[model samples]
Target chain A: MDLKTLTIVVVVASFILYIAIAIWAKARSTGDFYVAGKGVHPIANGMATAADWMSAASFISLAGIISFAGYDSSVYLMGWTGGYVLLALLLAPYLRKFGKFTVPEFIGDRYYSKTAKVVAVICLIIISFTYVAGQMRGVGIVFSRFLEVEILTGLIIGMGIVFFYAVLGGMKGITYTQVAQYCVLIFAYMVPAIFISVQITGNPIPQLAFGSNLAGQDISLLAKLDEIVTMLGFNAFTAGSKSTTDLLFITAALMVGTAGLPHVIVRFFTVPKVSDARKSAGWALLFIAILYTTAPAVGSLARLNLINTIQPGEVGAVDGNLKYSDKPSWFATWEKTGLLTFDDKNGDGRIQYYNDKNESFKAKADSYGWKGNELKVDRDIMVLANPEIAQLPNWVIALIAAGGIAAALSTAAGLLLVISSSISHDLVKGIIAPEISEKKELFIGRVSAAVAILIAGYLGANPPGFVAQVVALAFGLAASSLFPAILLGIFNKRVNKTGAVAGMIVGIVFTLSYIIYFKFMHLELNNADNWWFGISPEGIGSLGMIFNFVVALVVSKVTEEPPQEIQDLVESIRIPKEV
Target chain B: MSSKENREAYWKANLKLMGLLLSIWFIVSYVLGIVLVDQLNTIQFGGFKLGFWIAQQGSMYVYLILIFVYAKKMNTLDKKYGVED
Candidate 1:
């Protein structure tokens, strides 16, 4: 079948599947809505968490970033996965033992102050909204590309699907649907990766394929990719050029941020027991690792394939590589999306894809009668364009499109649910109207979810930058603010309301202001001119987290300990037997 | 020690297990992946360098194993401490 027809079929099938799950898992009570009735099997919850955790960034952009940025991008892989260790070890079991419906609930009760809860709610909103915006944009991109619809149209359709399920099923329906999404997305991701790996390295496992020798070549895949990219003026694929300190801070920020994210932490609350929460985190990581391990392989193989396809022979051939006239159909198709663009800078009909940034390489291109870099490859296109790059079956390509949309939509739905719940349940019911009825609260939740979707859709329609970069900002904010506060609130009984609230405010303000100043406001002076302590805005959040820890500790020491009742609450949360 | 003191000793051992695991957590990623990466790079694994491996893949695999290890060991500790859940 044609790609368009196959894409439409996949979309319709996925939509039907989602609606069915939502209807089947329709939440009956506030408990069902908030914590999936707290009966989710560990493995099932693991699968759902993987789907929720992967999001559009993991499914679509992670491999792409690695493929292009090479070793400098290792920060993303380590940071994201490392956070799960923190979650499993430090936070999950205790949070589960706390037996709370939401993260804010744990904070409020632990700190013995509604003010702490309010700060947490605000942090949650900012972090989740920042996160949801990226997911919404990812949904729009996938929809527009595969379904041949306008970006806004795709976003609206995405919103409608999320609204139908999230409004009806809440976390319960979302969890089941996420399981289905996990299957689709992982299958979609692996099939193309496996095909490419086998094609390149005669290996099926992407992780091993990366280290294994390339087909018809004695060199390993990474070795070959390193040789090729460096030959083209790019740094060796396995070597990092970024400052070690910066990379360290970014990795730290991402790890803490992952632990701090409200959506992920809240997932632990869905399990039935404290031990199950601990086990579920391990299971979730195991599931996530399936994709994470494969990601580097995909990145390396795709980078190799991309270089090979564009160059099509040994570099510096006198007769020149294949003409632009002979470029693959995939190239033309992606070019239409503006993700892959080509300009015959020298007015020669041949395309030269190389590092225009490297002076030495630029000299070689000039010596070889090549013009300025002819290929302008956007990183986002790498995953979307993978199937076509491998010349895979049309259905696999269609499946990838569907999978990408599933990844984006599933995460957007999850984020929207959390945002709506924080507003309707935490802020409105818990604080504003403590006497609100369950029915009224449920109504507010549904309406707020729909409205949140609209706002996310608007942001996605006009995204600020790369999806992953925007997500990094979200992670930075969460790491500095929510993670520290939550960690202290759970583990340190002396972390009174003053400490918790002050920590969150200071952390978020420091991180957000650093980002705004460096990334937006101070850029007019040039990037090199502005940063504080030589820390880029991307890594400054780690400094903010440090500040948060210090302030929280100092404030806690100065302030009275939390009331005895709150101290007992903390002790109860720490002991699994109580729950 | 009295039987009550023996029970307290068991609890202390469990806490000690947690302390050890937590220390490993800080050391492996923070110390190896970040602080000692350059020094570790003096060592090699396969064709790749050790620091690169830790930053890219090694730490993650270790993290996975650490959780299972923590869980398994903690289960034994829980039983000893009469705190199994």
Candidate 2:
């Protein structure tokens, strides 16, 4: 069968499976809708959490980003995975013991203020929305590419699948569906990586193969990659280009942000017990590590393959580069998507994929009669086009398409659930209509989920140009605001409503302003030289988090202590078993 | 000890374990992975630079182990404190 047909069949079959699970696990009460009735087994919840955590970007863009950024991209891998440690050790168990339906609920009760809950809800909405818009766009892209449909049609189909499961089955449905999604996505991701690893390094294990020598060559893969990239005027593939301070701060920000994300933290609330929450976090990280370990291997292998395909011979030889007219079929396939482009600078009729921005390389390039770099490839295409570039079977390609969709849909469902629950549970039931029936609250939850889906779909369909940049802001906001607030609420009982609220406001505002000043308002001055303490905007959240910790501590010390019950509440959450 | 004092001791023990484990976490990802990366890159580990491997692969593996270790140790702590659920 053709790749397109195979992709549609696989994707549609997965959707059917999700819808079936939703029907089987349909939520009946507010508890089921918000927290899956708190009966999810640790392993199952871990798998579901893994699916919810690995978004479309993780599936499609991360390997590509790693390939291009080289050592610099370690921030993402370490930052993202390291956060789970924080979650497991510091956050998950206590939050589970708190027995809350939403993050804001804990903040509200712990801080003993309705206003604090409102503040948290607003932060959750902002972070989740900023993150979800990108997922929708990812779903639309996968659909358009594989199903040969317009992006709009693809988005509607994606939205419909999410709506069926999320609105009807709620958290219960999302959990089971996400477990299946984890299976599909991990399998799809690994198959091509295994094949490519075996092909290049004569090894089946991608993680080990990454450090091994090429199949017939004496030099190691990393060594060869370093040599090649440096020869092309790029930084050595295994060397750090960014300042160490920046890497440390960025990694810290991502770790803190991951632990703080409402969608991820809520998954812990679904587990049966406090111990289960800790165990489930471990399981989630293990599952996530399967992909994380393999990603660098895939990245290195893909970069090597890309360079070999483009520049088949010596780097500077006149007859080195592949003739543009003789470019491979995979190149043409990607070019049709407008993600890969070629310009015949100096009318060479050959592709030169190199660092044209390197001033020193300019002299040599001019010597070779090369006016400039003649090829431009989007980073996202690296993962999408890897199977094709490796000449893998049609089924493998089809599986990749399905995997991307599964990733996008699972994460999108998780985010939408959090958004809806914050509205219906926290806003409507907790504050607006405190006396509402459980059935009415469930109905309101469904309605809000449906509305949230529509808004997400619209944003996905007409994604703003800044959607990509805004995602980092989501992590920054979560790290600076929610994480510190939650951590202090649990660990430091003296942090009253005033201190916590002031800390959150200060952290969020500081992080937001710094990111905006560099990323948006003053883009021209975003260089390292002008940055504060050599910390880029991407890494500034760690600073904001520190500021939050300091301000909260000082403010709490100066003010009255929390009420006796609130202190008791803190003491209760710390114990694994109830008194 | 009174029940409240027992709970306080249990919480203190839990915090101590977290402190030790979190210290390792800090050293691996930040200290070795970033602060000492360049110095360690001069040394080779198998086919990878020592620091680069730590940054990209080793630290993540360590994080995986730390979580499981924390879980197991906490299980023991819970049992010792008569707080197992």
The recovered share of true contacts, given per candidate in order, is: 0.40, 0.80
Clashes of each: 0, 0
Worst 10 residues of 1 chain A by lDDT: A525-534
What tens-digit string does per-residue lDDT give for candidate 2 at A117-204?
9999999999999999999999999999888899999999999999999999999999999999999999999999999999999999
Candidate 1 structure quality by residue, lDDT tens digits, A82-115: 8888898788988988886888888777877889
- Candidate 1 deviant stretches above 4 angstroms: A464-469, A524-529, B1-15, B34-44
Winning model by lDDT = 2
How far residue A191's Cα lies from its native spot in candidate 2, in Å, is 0.2
Q: What DockQ do you compute for every candidate structure? A: 0.46, 0.85
Alpha-carbon lDDT, every model: 0.84, 0.94
Model 2 ranges with Cα > 4 A deviation? none
